[model samples]
Target: MESQTVEYKSDIPTKHKLFKAEIVAFLNTNNGTIFLGVDDDGTFLPEKVDQYKQWESWISDWIHSAFSVPVQKFVTLEVSAQNFAIHIKQGDKPPYYYKDGEGFNSKGIYIRNGSSKRRATDDEVRRMLKAQVANEFESELSNIQESLTFHYLQDKLLDNNIVFDPKGLRLQNVDNQYNNGALLLSDQSPRVTKIAVVDGLDMSADLLAKKTFSGSLIKQVDMTLEYISLLNDTKVSFTGAAARVENESYPSKAIREAVINAYAHRDYSLSADIKIEFFDDRLEIFSAGGLPDGLSVADIKEGISAQRNPNIIHVLDKINYIENFATGIRRILASYKGFHKEPMFIVTPNQFKVVLYNRNYALVDDDIQSWGNNKLKTNLSDAEQLELGFTVNQDHNLFDDSCVTELEKRLDSKDEKIIKLLRLNEEMSRKEIESYLEEAQTTVYNRLKRLIELKIINKRGQSRSTVYYMKANESK
Candidate 1:
């Protein structure tokens, strides 16, 4: 209990965060032994020996059920001298983490710093990665949630005659241990793709909509694309040569490639999530981490891609999520052809951003929206049309006159009078009905509300402007 590789606990911390955190810390740092049935002062509880099986089963279940990544092979338990010990070996895959009811603590990487344990700094984690020969973070084994389903992933790969083989897909290591990549592709993936729709350009602008997509990575991509597609309004220009020239505000191909690239090339090591923001004038996609060292915005524009998560890219490729390794930028650029504004790729020390300009931002037309009355056709009476020297096509009437004839047989005599007035005229205001029936406004209003519900006739306009009309179909 006093050694550098040993930690003492009088009992297993089943409900506390310390239980898994201590083991994960050991795996991320130097391998260590956790002594149960013993206190830090070296006091041993002999009764715990009888409950070793229960303790072991509980902990084993936690590691298996609670974690997404398979890391059971690295931890073991032994019992002797009234002390049950949990032996955690230093993992070949660094940065092991623990998850609780609240979910994964990405910053849970811990190390033994002499007498106690502490979180490993970014430098230490980077050093660990270097020592591990720069293994991609997605390739590292995890125990965040051991049980993962890939039904969505399987469907995507199914057409290619590719089965969901974790090992073959590099989602699992050679030992069949699922890595972070598996967690991402799994149906129970914890990774999230967040999007914000703002009324204006920046964070200071009003948020119009917000959505967070999760589950399988491929599913997230598909769903996010579908959502953006809905927002990317399609405009048709009738002015063009007999054929319709329809174009989306932003080219859909560019949006798909840009979104997939955000997930495929983003630095998975960073805790920050990929951010996609939709503004009135443009779309901005920002992923954690910049282009790999020695790569610049110019290189990216020239179609040079330095994949930070190649393993992730490979899985996506199997499902055709990517068109080609480095063609996303080129595709985005090509989409803006003939447009005055060009797409931009911004690279900072910690973030990589893609800004896509909107093509229809300036082409908004108010003439397309009509402020006409909500009627099937014109509000003019047949007499008015005839008086204006216009032929009122009797066949073009919205109301089926036969429909009013049928209602006459079912309505009360008082309601029949109102119905008769509407039948004589194309439409009638509430005041006109009240005047004809010589009834209180309240009585006429109640009759109209019921008639509208019965679907005998339809009501239009609002308040004093409200008018009732008999129609062949129910009002929307």
Candidate 2:
């Protein structure tokens, strides 16, 4: 039957162009077998026996001159007394095009489409080029001459009863010649892994803390995880009978999987670093390189993965850093099912970001109606106006008189404090509120929830970057 990898020719065609297309198609695609004596209807008609050697010679010379690299080794001619078959193996370096002045540019690259050969489109050619680069990049040798150390990786492998000797390293593509993958796992590789904690939601805010970890990538994974774990605080709730319900700010498994995914799949060719930013409302992990070719965000969410660095994945898998391929995104989503806000993935041509919101700092939905309440012309109670330190002027009106009266009736002292703080600033984060009031974070959180319920203020942004603003107008 006709397929992408098989083409049948009834007899030797008169023109060399027909053979050229089929051979180029096979080299661009997977290895294919071309049967010379077979017709579309499966009838066998042999070509002149003496012409077999001539045809083979012509094809070999044409392919060698047309491609940038020698393709003679990939082309083989099988000539039996009764039949002839031309077999072409897929080329390692692809986008094989016709020689210049053959009436085509790089877009002249061809691939098998069903049983026919067609020129590749610009996007298709680009994908083929990227795939070629990705496959060769990790196994390529690096110039780093420093003696490599793998104490961390060795210990991890030894714990699992796996030997990590030089021979084993070469087997895993980490040879003494120091491949790019080896540079990544080296103790003094130039790659940097950093985490930044910001006070505000975006980088516009002050930097509270920043930590950089360098060394072997495997060791960086552990060090980064340990640093993040310190910030993944647990909240304890005591209801009754000495029972406590504890919840972490971010799920441990989800963060671990994301970190592992960053290290294993990130593009090492770029000089960019892998960064993790912690804001008051959310955590974001940024890795160099976008989704690997032939993959989309939806595909990843559905558990489809394309490894950009197979050798890194191989070494990581040996050390138990990655349990299964293509399951990281699924596991991350599953870790937040039902209760936590779902994670978000942002992909660009050069970068991929994972955003995880803090479950405990989620905004109360009641605050949605209170946005834009600043235009309301209602007067506030004397005590409420005094607490907010505002006079009911046309522009400074905090809420409608009715909404303000309702708010004053319901707000406790801490609620009043949060509302007062939001009144002074255009917006305030949960942490900022906590700091201003010198109160416990949970206490500030509860007070903000109450203010939201009273419709005195509205929540804006999300995650650690979330901010509270006084409602511009109150809903009827």
- Best candidate according to TM-score: 2
Model 1 residue pairs with clashes:
67-144, 67-145, 67-146, 68-144, 68-145, 68-146, 69-142
Candidate 2 whole-model C-alpha lDDT, 0 to 1: 0.73
Q: Give the TM-scores of the predictions, in the order they appear.
A: 0.51, 0.57
TM-score of 1: 0.51
Candidate 2 Cα deviation (angstroms), residue 171: 6.5
Candidate 1's C-alpha runs over 4 A off are: 1-135, 365-476
Residue lDDT tens for model 1, 65-166: 544355678788887767688888767656667664456556666777665788878877775554343336777787764577889889889878888788
Give the top-scoring candidate (lDDT).
2
Clashes of each: 7, 15
Candidate 2 runs further than 4 Å off:
1-105, 110-131, 171-176, 238-243, 363-476
Tens digits of lDDT, candidate 2, 1-476: 87877888866578655567688788887678898766785566664556677766776687678655567888888878766788898776677766556454674578888888988888878767766676677778777656667777778889989887644554233334667787778776789898887756799975656788998898889989987876675554433333456767789999999899998888777779999999878899999877774457998998877778877788888777887658999999999998646999999756889998887565323233443343342344434543564333211234454555466456665575565455435477888777656778887788788777776688878898888888862231
Worst 10-residue lDDT window for candidate 1 reads 390-399
